[model samples]
Target: MSTSSVVTAPWRLLWRLGLRSSPLALAAPLVRTRPDPDLAPVALRAAGADVAAEPAALESAFPHATDRIVVLVPDTDEDESAWLRHLDQVGGTYASRLAALLDWTPVNVRVSPGEGTAVEVATTLQALVDGWPVPVRRIALIGHGRGGLVLRAACALRHQTPDAWHELVSDVVLLGTPHLAVPAGRTMVPLSRRVDEELAGIVTDDVVDVSAQPLPHARYALITPHTRLQQSRLGGLLGDVLWWRHRLPMRPRKARSLFPSATLHHVPTHEIGLVNHPDVHQAMLAWLA
Candidate 1:
């Protein structure tokens, strides 16, 4: 054998062996580790993500407690019961539980228009609070996504509407609501584009500058949930891009800036899903307690 061949033989063999042993080189990217069954999901809401879900009507919706009521706002692509879905599957609803704690009943606001107008929704809430035939004692509000904006609009009208909303709303909890401007959605899908348009319309018409404006007689809880990275279809290359694109503009600082009096709780997991999570329930209850 030549001198050079002999000298490189051992090195070549080691390199080949190393390739076979390395997980990244040849092995399939399977056997991904998953969390334990007991693992709880966590999330945070950023200010730039706007939800475009349609809200519901008042009388036909959830049961109401005239004396005491807890109102929950559903985020994008969700309804009034969005917060209750997880808890309902487990046992009861977080809203009802919270209402019970404060001797209140859960009430969700749904606008008359099927498509949902922000002004109408806010007006309805104000009317309810102001027009209650009986003497109402306690009222609490929990809003997810765009619901937060609507509630803020409702509360902003405390003086204009003659509703004791400012005085009645004892506690307010916001789940990842976008109280400020959301991004112009880059989603290429046609349906998603329509939703984005609707959201933009709401931002233009419904959004109020509640910056540094705290609701009167209300305790604020602003919870932010970090979103999980979705598995990418193009081997995660595109997936990572899309994930950051949606989440990058989301800033907890925006939420904090909007509600200075709010007690902020951030969960850097998958930004809250389309539905509510139980761990969030515990967190809100603990805060109130």
Candidate 2:
């Protein structure tokens, strides 16, 4: 058979296998994993709600509320409108899968975009939480592509700021994040390596491998899975055609922080692909539950 013919079955087979093995396949009682005892009972503050001055007010309102909020902070302000649109589609797919599997409302929290790199994003999160009456319980910070890199850097930033680590973070999740460096058009290789390597030289913090740091006893981690989405439209259309195959990198990549520990969950590129991968996000939700 031709290479094109070969592509059809292998991906399908992998998808089937994933479905059969996951516990998420069976009905599982998923709930919020991290519950902050110190946080006073309070309601869920609306998005853009005032978490700046009285972040603790949230804790007081939904002390026992499931604080599994998703923070939507993009790393750069560059008008990747096209890319962001694709991400929104993927995010919606992820939300749907979560709803079908666990029936939970997916929370999307947003941090400012273009403010800075991963560290800057984390700094923003810190500032937002510093004044909180109670900190978030089961926090799941998720970003797409470059946003994921920013999220990784933000997790590392949390490690540096011990005070912020007290009750704000739980698990950091990335959707189709690139951890290595790639050329302008290549989709498989990460684009952040050059920057991370450069930063590693200036900062004694060893910021290059931002994924390796341990956060405040939280389960610091990453989510890398395969998807049809590529770095560019042409790449996406080709769909994992050699250079566009997205996966975790070998060197100078985002290291899952030991402070919180990390896990790598690979998904098939088609059928139940990363965006719709049953086990990947569902497993995290299960674990967090």
Candidate 3:
């Protein structure tokens, strides 16, 4: 943490906590150098309403899949769009590119992951994988926002079953995932006020420490924005039930990997667009290659 960022963290927290009262907004734009977004003309649209459920296994599920698969885990948001469509919007494109690069087929979990804790999500993910009835030699996980945390937790959750799918994940890509709490000027996007209601309840005070018991046989690439840490600048400041916490504060803290050995890529974009940003996707493709 830089001296300026550390010194200013508490005040930033105050502004983030109080929402509108803090002078941090004007002052932040002044003191903190906001990175140039340099945004491409991308349609940053939200997904539409939900659709009826469909069969789990289609006739051509993973037709190009061999002994390898790349799974895209998207954050559970209010976007009621079909899971597959939303996944495509978020990281499915990168997944397809990655799959083509490595001769792996991209796929999503059998069902939309319902409500659960990280461990519960992990177990459910594994159960769904087990039921797939497909031969798998290796697995690669790429997740955005909270979905990244779920994927990390699943990787950490040891599997007792013989030759489990969890054991096959060789690579993990975390897009805009917070891995710490009350970060000191840690580069991250703040949780949207709305995400707190649905996501905050479960991820409260939870920490996915990559430092301890590092994921075995797995390489990690954490991609997040270089922008300021806080989000919800316009939303109401005061939240009920303490909604500010995350898996924890994540990013390059003090010019180093907050995730220790993991390679870090910083991009210029909003949290959601981390998956869409070219720097992020390019770094992802390079890392996997």
Candidate 4:
């Protein structure tokens, strides 16, 4: 069949499957994460990395509250070693957590897991600021992968606990994550679905009800590559050309909706090289500013 025919065929199927031509919205419905009891915590001792035992000490080290805040939220299931591995593979030039903190110097805090679902990390942050020296004015959050989703969940929970949010919470920023794909939109569709199935209570319609809140007091900056948009956009334009020649369905933009208050931005991997774009740290800082 002709290349044109191939492109048209899949789009038709997608349309039948409820795909809409209108630009995809950035906001996603409330989604939650389930703890993997089977995945034992890899001893941090083996990884040889220093992880803070106390959440408050971690918050105090960097000053995200006074001026511009950078909160580092890691993937839901990933332990410290996984974070280190990601940094190492990226040539260690930047610590994913540290790099984000440095972008906006006011203060940087790294949120950690605290005895519940990954969402607890956000709750933990709330607990830390019960009576902070300075009230959290503005926030700039940076979450990686599932951690990004956790950030959204954190914001959602604030509504349920207005007093807690008023006390210490501010705003959020997300790193490389796909917000709209809840269970089947894109990016780990099966994973999202599995999470929704097992934990239906939290991952309900309001998980990220962008329409209701419209514009939460936050700025969200997302970095995506067309090639690596799904995985990594390495190689070159020639490679992209070849990919389109053979790859099917015309890669759809897999993105999530940020509240109307957000200033949404994208960094294509072709120019910067896909997969893990190095400039995300800077991009986030500038967006927050």
Instruction: Give lDDT tens digits, candidate 4, residues 199-261.
Output: 111222334443333225444555432322221121121132222123356754232344435
Better of 1 and 4 by lDDT: 1
Model 4 local distance difference test score? 0.40
Each model's lDDT: 0.48, 0.41, 0.49, 0.40
Q: Give the local distance difference test score of model 2.
A: 0.41
Candidate 3 TM-score, C-alpha based: 0.55
Which 10 residues in a row give candidate 4 its minimum summed lDDT?
229-238
Question: Could you estimate the TM-score for every candidate?
Answer: 0.54, 0.46, 0.55, 0.48
Better of 3 and 4 by lDDT: 3
For every model shown, the clashing-pair count is 15, 27, 5, 15
Cα error, residue 61 of model 3, in Å, equals: 2.2
Write model 1 residue lDDT over 1-289, tens digit each, in one string. 0111112232332242233455354222111234233421111111222222213223323235357767666653344545555554556567666766645556555322123344555555555655454556777788776567666655665455444456767788887664344343443433323332232222322234544266756898776532211222222321222222243445531112456678766543222232455566677667555
Error of 2 at 276 (Å): 5.4
Q: Candidate 2: where is the Cα deviation over 4 Å?
A: 1-107, 111-115, 133-135, 158-162, 166-168, 181-221, 226-261, 271-277
Candidate with maximal lDDT: 3
Residues 1-289, candidate 3: write the lDDT tens digits.
0112212233443443333464444233112222224421111121222211122442134334466767776663312122333354565667556766767666653222333345654665565456444666787787766666666655667878886777887888877665443323323424333333222212223233443344768888776544334342323343332245333357332221334546766554422345555565566667666
**Candidate that would win on TM-score:** 3
